[model samples]
Target: MANYFRDYADLCFEAFGDRVKHWITFSDPRAHAQAWHSYNSTWRGKQRGLVGISLNCDWGEPMDISSPKDIEAAERYLQFCLGWFANPIYAGDYPQVMKDRIGKKSAEQGLDMSRLPVFSLQEKSYIKGTSDFLGLGHFTTRYITERNYPSRQGPSYHNDRDLVELVDPNWPDLGSTWPQSVPWGFRRLLHFAQTQYGNPPIYVTENGASQKLHCTQLCDEWRIQYLKGYINEMLKEPLLSHMQMVTEIVVPTVCTLCILISAVLLMLLLQSQS
Candidate 1:
């Protein structure tokens, strides 16, 4: 299957790799890994392009920050959603929280092995570092809390997380109830990716909302606000990134010089008075 996909990819690269600098290699990591291998091994020497996978994930904010259950559930939510695909490609396996939880559930259900896929050491090495860049798609946030389902509910991906998702009543609804206009969520998801993926170069694959309700006169104030808020949040990351090293070098040196100068000034002032 992978080699078949690679043949198609090689054809595409042969035809258009000169013009296209970035390639997604279609959906799913298996195909992506195959494409990555093909590009790096065969074409990358001459073509010179990047291969990556696009991931769409919403921020999972905890309903109650003080509650441990809620916090754990929120983290679990992210691990299940983004980490489901991104983990193997980036970190070489599923999230530990996911493996532990799903494995436990599968054991309770009388399964011999885990429902979640396992990557052998060699497979992990191959899958890891497949992405040249991380393509991200983010929009909204969901408030999460822990919720235990009955063990008899049977094996399912949806039930494995054991969390309930909620949204603030005040957030603006964009047709469906699932994705509300929660601009701050974009920032949170970006930071999570930055931390989780070791600061990979990120290109936001998809964002903004569709005007599903009305488009009579080509007016979309909601979309305008959404773009402004979300783009603003995404742009806010540079202040906290590589700048930290510069700040660490500059701040303490300036503070120490200021303290010494202040002490010298006070001593001179007292001598002048005497």
Candidate 2:
């Protein structure tokens, strides 16, 4: 990941800023802000519109809805996931709370030289408000339950958060293990993003459904139905008004009747030619 970050920076400059408009630097923001900012001028005034990182956000809700600890845990999990990216793009720093949690261990892990990479005063100032818009990739909502510290994951940030995911089978399943279609959760996630990042304009970079289906009669009626239903649910959320739905590559199914008719036509044509 670290090497990829540096390479993206080099390539961004090499492209001379003419070919690229929106740049998403994929790396730990705190650790690589300098390299990223260095490319800003390299592409400036080249019709290049915006530059920012793509973030994967978990929209979390509590599993034990009545448990205060679970509620808090849910909140923390969202903050940890979303805030990690938003803090740098908006606030120009790591979420202060998160730093206090995992910054030390990361330091001892040979990141001591620069556990959370430092941004020069100018770099931080430049990086603040660098986002054209926050791009969020959200799929499903997980029900978070607070748990005791994980069993020896070696001081990782996620481990420190102590969030265990509990899924509900009741949430309409479009047929993936990870994503149970919780339409309301999508709304809640948008609301949280708006409130947390001061309502930065958001673009849904990716959202879609998947079904583990096997061909029995060679009909994909189930897949088509899943798309129709999920899309209906997605459209209900006003925040997703601007969102776009892209159906994955679907191989067209051959109709049995059509195939039979074509075969008969072929036989008739062959007979006439003979």
- Give the top-scoring candidate (TM-score): 1
Give TM per candidate: 0.88, 0.66
The clash numbers for all candidates, in the given order, read: 0, 0
Residue pairs that clash (backbone atoms under 3 angstroms), model 1: none
Per lDDT, the best of the predicted structures is: 1
User: 132-200 in candidate 1: lDDT tens per residue?
Assistant: 999998878999998965534567877899989888999986665456899888998998999888999
Window of ten residues with lowest summed lDDT in model 2: 244-253
Cα shift from native, residue 28, model 1 (Å): 4.4
How many clashing pairs does model 2 include? 0
Give stretches of model 2 more than 4 Å off.
1-21, 27-42, 103-123, 148-152, 211-274
TM-score of 2: 0.66
| Cα lDDT tens digits for candidate 2, 99-201 | 6656655765656553455667886686677776677777777889988664467666667577798778777765445566666676677768766777677
Question: What Cα-based lDDT does every candidate model obtain?
Answer: 0.87, 0.67
